[model samples]
Target: MEVTIIEDQFILKTKVFFNNQSLQYLKKITGSRALIVSDSIMETLGYLQEVIDYLQESGITSTVFTGVRPDPDVSIIADGLKLYRESGADVLVAIGGGSAIDTAKGILYFERKFESTEGKEMPKPLFIAIPSTSGTGSEVTDFSVITSEGEKVVIIDEFIAPDIAILDSTCIQHVPQRVVADTGIDVLVHAIEAYVSTKATDFTDALCEKSIKLIFENLETFFKDSKNTQARDRVLNASCIAGMAFTNTGLGINHSLAHAFGGTFHISHGRSNALLLDAVIEFNANLGGSADGYAADRYAKLAEVLKLPARTRREGTVNFMLALKRLKKSLKVEDNIRSLGINQSEFEDALEQLAETALLDRCTPTNPRQPSKQDLIRIYQKCY
Candidate 1:
């Protein structure tokens, strides 16, 4: 194994300590005032009070910004940026899943460098992302995705990476099963895509492999029994690991399709990823030859890690489909895009736009196969 392959920098620098006790460490280093960005659901879940108490006990005041929504948009992030600037918060603490964390990232980014988006440097604020769910490892990565006019926009920079990530296992206790399923599948997609990505390196490959094994072994347990702390912890750790891997390696066609469709239709990102992942994987597999065979080998490795029956390329493809099928059934997730309330005409009309948007997405460049507009359309059609 080559320890030095290329000049690659994996800048997932967030210092994380799991379990509920990590809050004490967080309380110790936090400043006088921190902005806690979360959503209404999380606030109602009483996490806000718990965090506020922790802050107050440590003599650190906090300003709460609880307006974040699921699959957060640019407008929501802009609002968060305003709140962060007005509140004079020196530190930003995100206390939910991806939405809250993405919002916090955007807010902190805006505050540190560009007040008006006119003239600014490349860096931003020191952020702390504490995930309350077991997926969408926004806690660890410097990538933030926000929507604008039904298009997914991403901001990726090392400066946007959080200064700290506190993964309290207790946070995963009350997450709904649907969320677990959708985000868990997203985790799986991240791991698989990272392992096979053109940008994959030794560092990211290791993280991706470990994350795949963890998700394979524990995600079902989490879905079966939501209170299984050990399983939840494994899944949560895997989520962060996958995030680290994909942040460096980027994603593949699964993400490209998901971003395009979800952004256009207002569907959940994780669910969109889940629906398209298997289809994209199959499509990538059939393109044939050395590079394509390498992609198949990666999926075969993932299948073996998951203990699926994958000896040949065909078996590997079967394993991928079966595993995804089991996941969909276990989670009671629908298979088609139409089930998400997107009519046939809407999908057909948006097909060209989706193809264009996906082709232009940042993740598309890293895909093993650089698919064309026709390829994207065919992939989407297969998914439907």
Candidate 2:
């Protein structure tokens, strides 16, 4: 199956490889020279070398850039661009977690942006994303989050989406329990947010529902036993499914809040999203509000998909929220931002700024409920 999105004169399409050794096919599609974008950890895990060996066997010369950091900023992009230019590679391969993929996207995005300004025509490199972690799903999404001036900036364009996504579970077999939990919850949040997004269509809804079910059924097993190949594959596929869903439908305020809070506090993106999920869900439902009940009805439909008991829409929404809380607890994720160990005074000082920044986040537009700054503040406080 394939999905296509047409927005503002751009067409976005991604090809996914599931449970297959995608590297075997790399030779068939790649250019003669490849620029590998990753972090040091990928090197330590030997995954980087494995990729290099595959490329070499395919007669594709490759150079390495391992400077990507968590919540990468513009500086990382600058560094990567320098490496990309020096390598003179015609293919760009991102291997590692979301950070690496996002860094590669940043490099490509800024390069294109610069070329446009200079009125110089530069062909985009063949971009392939190999996710070593089952989170973020950056491999299939047209969105990249780059932190600049203490804000997580969202860059969206069809050009940022990778030409191919390699979803081999072998790459994630060594993921730590903490990351498994964090990224797993990220998949769930991505699914829920996309399912409730204002832009959701029947296609996105189906993908989101399937992704949510996969996470619920597989995350725990994968967390408990990282070597469980079946569980790992399921979760990895779920992450990609969620990624494809959100890329088309867009995410909601849960991601908006996460981007703001994470950029401000240096929290992991998935952890930030996990902490804020329940609060955002409740806010979006607006059970007692006089506004349109569409979001609430959607929430109930999701509950039905999950087989959660509900006598009414409100009851289903509440039950779904409870289920999420329970899942977080089982995964050992923190229930609230306060529990993540930010200083109370620091949090208080940053509350208003965070709320305001969240309101400006790109993900906010498709949120089922429009939120005032005060509303965001209250939600942050409630989570805190």
Candidate 3:
């Protein structure tokens, strides 16, 4: 049992906050010239005022950029970059879910480039990502997903990773039930995928396993009663842990397939993850080779976490699919990619293009079981 796992190295520079009050300290530490990048939904949730008041209390100067949209596009990043330039922001504070954080990271990346070009060589803009929803782990990872011409492109660089991650349960208190459900699916996928990732190391594997257990135990509670503080805390922490895990261990078919679906159909990332997760798990289980046994064993562990029987490989495979079915039903999630408003004609129209784009996605090669072009198309068909 003392197997030495490979060490995956990444800069975990982000500090964390438990309660919302830590915003004051953040502003004080950063000397108050912060630009807040948030989405319309968060602005409506009164987080905007809460953040502003905290900043004002600390005598911090802040500007707001509320233009981020769901599944942020590259154009949004450009907009944020413009704001970052014009405002001369010293810190980039992100106060929402993955979308806001991803958008902010992209903006910060470009902001540094612009700043460096002007000979004003400032340190990379510091970012604090406060996740209002418990998914995507964008708060901690150096990875940012941006859409470009209907393709999900992942930007990875240490400079783009957030400097701090603030997890406040109160921020998630008013989130809709559907968001919690959908995002929980992403959390689960992150942990499972990281567990079996080809890049998995001891540090990431530990985080992934812990994340899987926490998500498995508390997701239902958080969904059933959104106000359950303990459940919400567990869920949010699990999401962050999974984020750190996958950032180093990386993701596999689940994310590649999700990115493909997200880019083509404009479905939310979590929903995309949910739709393709089981299918990819099944596909991977049947894949046999040098690493196949190790992969299958990890999948079996995942099955056990889901309370599915894992007595044998065959049983574990069956349980994985059945568990996904039960999970979708429990979460009131729909099957059929068509439900995402993607017509059959549209999918048929984009099959070849989707296959090509998915092959190019950053998350593809790190898959525990690599899929061929035909396999990718088949997976798409299965999800479809």
Candidate 4:
């Protein structure tokens, strides 16, 4: 006899605080000692001191580790873990962009893994994440993209998700407009990819739909006027909503190729995702001819939801890509990788290796379209 088991679950364990309530929440957080993880950027912006001051207000003694960098790797995580042990803090706080949050998660993830492997038991510290950027959604997602050697390794585990996510849009008000454009595009990619992901359930679809709509409504406004509180709040909320969707549904090859492209070229993660979004969507939709597949249908649904002209699935998909391109232009992003000023020869030289690395990326398995290495290379070529 043959037996089959079916399973489905939606998890939202992280408590989220919106508006400017993050500082208020900090005052009430339980813990006598805290370890704050951030980066030099946050420090220079005076945000690091702000967090320390709030923690002090709550009578929580703390230690700071401001060594996190963009695209944190194993060595960086190792250094953070060493600090975490030395500091002996009962609470762990990550108060910067995705890099700081990912670094914090990486530190905790390795510690937890080692404990399980070595047959040791230890109580997990209270983990809190305050995102300075609306991108990555690392605060609520269990996925961590860490660069190891030369490849970006995505570590996904239930244990890595943060216990609390504080969304204070004011944190991003001082950020550069270019960063606003990059992170906002990343949000769109997250929602679109999640909506079309093979693992997407009804719950995830609802979140993605809301997120995509909000992004359309608010991203450009926020990018143009960083001080628009209304736009900032909406876009920041949209980013978290998209994160929730993709965290459940998982993303597609857009993220995989972006991981490879960013790791190889030392490009920003959000920009890498932005450059690959159009090509990946086209590849998955199988644009011109066949629009009968799940991917095309979902893409069409997105276009319809966004109120783009869509008489058919193929039309809807194309229209959707066009809308994304329009958005990119408005945000002052380049049309392709070539326009981003990467040398053609250098990009060409890395295509094969990029394709190979992308093929093995953790995000690839759930991609609606299973791509060959050549298929991936073709995507890179298209983006170029």
Candidate 5:
């Protein structure tokens, strides 16, 4: 018997604060100046001013950069970097969804990269992430995806992970129902992908299992009643836990396809993932032509963990894929890219390029089943 020694190393460097009033913890950090990165909607919703008020109450001066946009691009990051450089802030705070946090990480990343190239030293700011949505988990992950020149560029490095993650369900209480459903499904995809990833270990598996169960139990309640405090908190925590797991285990073709498709169609990231998830699951579970059974076995294991009815591995795999589709339907997510209002002719024209981009995505390497461009294209077509 060849025994595989799986070295279990679980590292989570970010200090997490989870509670109803977790933003108050910012007062404990001894920084005199703070810079907040967010978007216009946050500003309009008064979240921006609320954070600024909190900093002021803590005796810290603050600057606001509200230029982040959906599917943020290099230019958005450059703008944020310029604001941070001029703010004279010792602490950086990101408030909003993944785009805001990703922009903040991008600013810090490029600043360090540029400084290193110039042989100059710059003090790193203390980074804090306050996610207003219960998805993406960008707050605790060593990853940031920024669009540039018609491509979604994924940046992964320990340096980009926030120093602290503050999870307060109150922040997400006002999120639109549609957004709630979209982001909630995103949490499920994160957990499922992390659980089945080739890099998954015992630690990540535990976190993924817990996260998945939480989403399944709480997402529907949270979506229907955003004011349900317990449901909101559970879903929020699940998002962060999933983020932590995927940061270590990495994601799969689902994320790769989402990134590419979102970049091309300008679709919301979470919604894009929701649309393609069922197709990707079926693709990963298929044991056709040189296919390894690792992913299929993992999917079956997940179904078992969820206590879905199954008599064997094949039944479990089928049940797992069906469960995902049923969940999407319950959440009111579209079943295909065509339903998302994408022009069929344009989608067909872009399929090859999208497939190529997905094949090169950073998340693709850790996927249990490696996919070729043609394989990715076929998946895209099926989803279409």
Candidate 6:
């Protein structure tokens, strides 16, 4: 039988909406038991209780696992999974940033692994993700980044994609300006990498184009004024739109290198991506200071979309990189990892392993330029 390629995600399966407390869908949940995965910040912010109260009102008993940390490792997943298996829950709710959502996903992932290992298939729980931060876009994406032995592992699995995504502006209201900067820049990297990915298609490009425009228009205002509700909504939309794009088209080396670098140096994922953005862009587009291939043209197209200077491929690419640098400066995020207090000797010592791990990251193969281990080392060295 002749068959066509079936893209893992053609239409987003997750039901998405915006609200004040992310409580609009609580009444619609069909399950009686829920495993709520979250973190201390959500507990401190009272968002955790809000979700719990909502679930209680829906007549759903819940198991709360609030031990999720930034860049969740295997141990968190194992612990959460143990709770999940023991709770006998039919619903999984992740109510925090990417870390918390990923913890829930990781639990589900290993749950599936357990089924496979034991030659049994358990009915998957209904998964819902409510992102407190406008970065990672973990609410809608079918990918999860987990830290294992000081290296970030990107787990790509369609089964773990949330059944629903809730964007609650209230949760983001008190986000630190520095976090806003980092998260907002992460949205840009997602859009850019998806746009230039070798696997990109017209459908993905359209989402990426809109996402990029939204970030350029609204991110600065959102960062500067947390009270700007309009900007907040737009940034949130941009994040989800970019997620839709990259989850379909996959991402590139910016993510790959960021994953490795962030894990090793204990940098925030978004900040790591921001530090690597400029060099990754230039590397993908050029070799020896001249624009190289289709990736350069793709970048030039993005420049055109942003209405930057795109008269020629090189000019457009340079202007685009310059624009990103300007945005980073405005946000006070410098491009140097060392300035983040990573020891020079430790960094130099880690370069080889970083490059090796980054080369194996799921995002690397989609990079417009196929990087060698030496190439990654050079990129790391240049950024340092």
Identify the leading candidate in terms of lDDT: 5
Off by over 4 Å in 2: 1-12, 288-292
How close is every model to the real structure, measured as TM-score? Answer: 0.92, 0.95, 0.91, 0.97, 0.96, 0.96
The digit string of per-residue lDDT tens for model 6 on 316-343 reads 8988888888889988997698788888
In model 6, the runs with Cα more than 4 Å from the true position are 1-9, 19-22, 287-289
Off by over 4 Å in 3: 1-11, 19-28, 115-122, 287-292, 305-308
Model 4 segments beyond 4 Å from truth?
1-4
Counting only residues 3 or more apart in sequence or on different chains, how many pairs clash (N, Cα, C under 3 Å) in candidate 3?
A: 0
Best by TM-score: 4
Clashing pairs in 2: none
Query: Which digits, one per residue and each the tens of the lDDT, describe model 1 over residues 1-384?
Result: 769677667666878877655766665765777788988777888877788888787777888999898777778888888888787776778999888898888776666557446665533444778888777888888788887776788778777788888888777778888889888988988888888898898899889989988887798899889889889889999999999888888888888889889888877888999889767887777633442476777777777767788878668766866887886777888888777777898799999999998888888888877789999998899788
lDDT of 6 at 357: 88
Record all residue pairs in model 3 with backbone atoms less than 3 Å apart, i.e. clashing: none
What global local distance difference test value does model 2 have? 0.88
lDDT tens per residue, model 3, 215-332:
7788888888988988988899999999998888778878887887777777888888888876787788774333246678788776776678989766776776686677677888
Candidate 4 lDDT by residue in tens digits, 38-139: 999889888888888888888999899988988998998999999999988899999999999999989888998888899997678989999998777888
What's the count of clashing pairs in each model shown?
A: 0, 0, 0, 0, 0, 0
What value does the lDDT take at residue 25 in candidate 1? 62
RMSD of each: 3.2, 3.5, 3.7, 1.4, 2.7, 1.6
Candidate closer to the true structure by lDDT (higher is better), 1 or 4: 4
Q: What is the number of residue pairs that collide in model 2? A: 0
Q: List the residue pairs that clash in candidate 6.
A: none
Q: At residue 91, give the lDDT of candidate 5.
A: 94
